[model samples]
Target: MSTAASTEACSTSRRMSIGMLYVDLGIVTRPQLFEALVECARTRCTLPAALASLGYL
Candidate 1:
């Protein structure tokens, strides 16, 4: 794969990892994490910013 593709994949995985960690910690529900993920995809923002936008952060 191209370097850009590899980097993007890495970042995406890292984002999901952080989200799941929050879920495991009971800081946010799975549904809330999914919502933030969707918003992150839509807004092209960072996961933390998306969580904040959804009031999960």
Candidate 2:
């Protein structure tokens, strides 16, 4: 498979694994979990200070 295809497959597997882990740990929904992840990720990016001012921090 191509690099992009492999990367996509890996991401899907990872999400499935994490979803199951969350279910086992009693997380209620994917939206809440992924939203938290996205927000957490935003904090670590370059120029995150701008986002912080925009209330993304």
**Which candidate gets the maximum TM-score versus the true structure?**
1
lDDT score at residue 19, model 1, on the 0-100 scale = 94
Against the reference, the lDDT scores of all candidates come to 0.90, 0.51
True-vs-predicted CA distance for residue 9, candidate 2, Å: 0.2
Off by over 4 Å in 1: none
Instruction: Report the lDDT tens digits of candidate 2 across residue range 1-57.
Output: 999889756755665576556656764355554554455345533223323444433
Return the clash pairs for model 1, or none.
Answer: none
C-alpha lDDT (0 to 100) for residue 30 of candidate 2 = 55
Shift in Å, residue 17, candidate 1: 0.7
Candidate 2 TM-score over all chains jointly: 0.48
Of the candidates shown, which would achieve the greatest lDDT relative to the real structure? 1
